[model samples]
Target: MKLQGVHHVAYRCRDAKETVEFYQKHLDMDFQLAIAENEVPSTGEPDPYMHIFLDAGNGNVLAFFELPSQPQMGRDTNTPEWVQHIAFKLGSMEELLAAKERLVDAGIEVLGPTNHTIFKSIYFFDPNGHRIELAANTDEPGMLQELKRVGPEMLEEWSRTKKAPKTAAWIHGEGEFPGYQG
Candidate 1:
């Protein structure tokens, strides 16, 4: 079965109202709709929850659930903060920088304009302690094509040694990538 696209992605929240407000104020996401029920429709369990939906632009939806009856929310302690995050694409470098400024103005501590070869990004935390990243693309025309060209070789090397292959190291401009390391 071929999949079309994501209808929505849902995560747990501490408070539905606060989650909605945070996304609205910070990310400019419109509150689309909210679903409240005393029982889960899919599981048939008697657990009350408030499910909220936000517009993530271009027909994409981000959702959250606030389960008041459950224990307080906590993240996986084993996972590093950067490993699990929600990343959003901003229109341009200017827009990404502006967002970082605005977030700092709102008393949020943000990190980076970190360059990832093909994009530049900033990182911050939302009210729920979820790491959020906003990135702007900066790749040259054939950048993606170049990466795709090396995909097979990279995967083959990785499969054999379980180590990061150097095929795409040009992005990092190190080791044999034809660039100064400093």
Candidate 2:
């Protein structure tokens, strides 16, 4: 079956009200709606929950569940904190920088303006300890096109070697390969 698009992305929050307020204040997400239930609709489990939805713009939605009956919220211990995060795109480099400044002024510790060759981003955590990234596109003309052209080859080489392929090393300002035009 063909999928339309993501309906919503849900994560666990410490508190529903706090989560709503945090997104509203920091990300400017509007509280769209909330769903409270005494039982799981799909599983029929006897659990109470508060599900909240926020407008993440462009027809996308960000949702959270306050599961009071569940155990204390914790992240995966085996995975690095930086590995799992929610990333939102900003319009430009200026917007990314401005967001970083605003988060810093609000007493939130932000990590970067980290350069990913094609984009720049900043990282910070929400009240629920969920890592959040705000990134802006910065790719030069033909940069993305060049990467797309080499993507399949890179993936195949990586699958066989389990090492990063050098096809895209030029993205890091490395010298271009023999046949690469970008």
Candidate 3:
């Protein structure tokens, strides 16, 4: 079956109001709607929560839920902090730089306009401790095609060894592989 597109991606938040305000002030996301219920619609269990949705440009939606009855929100102990992050694509490099400056000026510790060959990104954390990345594409011609060409081999090696395959090292700004420029 063919997939249409992502409806939304949801995550747990410490406070729904804080999350809404943060996204609105920092990322300029529009607070679309909020949902509150005493029971989960799908689970039929009695649990109170406040769910909120924010516009992430181009019809994309980012969502969060605050479950007051549950314990404090925390990330998976087994997962590395940097392993799971929400990445948003900015319109251009100018926009990306501007956003980085804005975040830094707001007293947020921003990481980088780190070059990834195909894109440049800056990373920061939200009030909820969620790592967020804003990226701008700067891929050269045929870069994605070259990466696509190695996809099969990369997956095969990764499946067998459960290790990162070097096939796409070019994308990470290792030795230049001709397709993408850093």
Candidate 4:
């Protein structure tokens, strides 16, 4: 079952209007469309929702649903705040920096342009308390291919030890092993 690409990814939002406005103003995503339903189509239960979609560039669509009848929306308490987030890719380092500044100027606290050697990224939260990341790639020649080659080994090592594997440490400026350097 080969797939072309992601159609859309959906998340629960506190307010549909606020979410649409935030994405439109801050991230420059187009507010594509909205949907309202009084009953669940699949479940046949009466659960009203306001669904909205935003274009997240490169044919990717980000979506949200505001369910007013349900309890307040929240994230998983057990998971670390940074563990679950929606990451968006920016065109270049310049665009990433500009986005960071724009978020800060809008009174949102942002965290890094943290350099990971292969890429740099900044993080911030939206009005709904959803963490978001904007990243720009800066990979060196053969970097991605090398990482891909080591992916299986890294996953195996991780599964066995539940520890970070050293195979891709160079991407974080960590000490490198031979045959894995620029």
Whole-model lDDT per candidate: 0.89, 0.92, 0.92, 0.91
Query: Top model by TM-score, which number?
Result: 4
TM-score of structure candidate 3: 0.94
Global Cα lDDT for candidate 1: 0.89
Per-residue lDDT of 26-48 in model 3, one digit per residue for the tens?
A: 99999999999999999999999
Model 2 per-residue lDDT tens digits across residues 97-151: 9999988999999999998888999999999999999999998777888888889
* Winner of 2 and 4 under lDDT: 2
How does each model score on TM-score?
0.92, 0.94, 0.94, 0.95
Which 10-residue window of candidate 4 scores lowest in summed lDDT?
Answer: 173-182
Per-residue lDDT value at 106 in model 4 = 92
- Report the error of model 4 at residue 100, Å: 1.0
- What is the per-residue lDDT of model 4 for residues 6-72, given as tens digits with 9 covering 90 to 100? 9999999999999999999999999999989999889989999999999999999999999999999
lDDT of model 4 at residue 27? 96
Error of 4 at 22 (Å): 0.6
- Summed over model 2, clashes come to 0
RMSD for all candidates, in order, please: 3.5, 1.8, 2.4, 1.7
lDDT tens digits by residue: candidate 1, 55-159 = 999889999999999999999999988999999999999999999999999999999999988899999988888889999999866777777777888999999
Off by over 4 Å in 1: 175-182
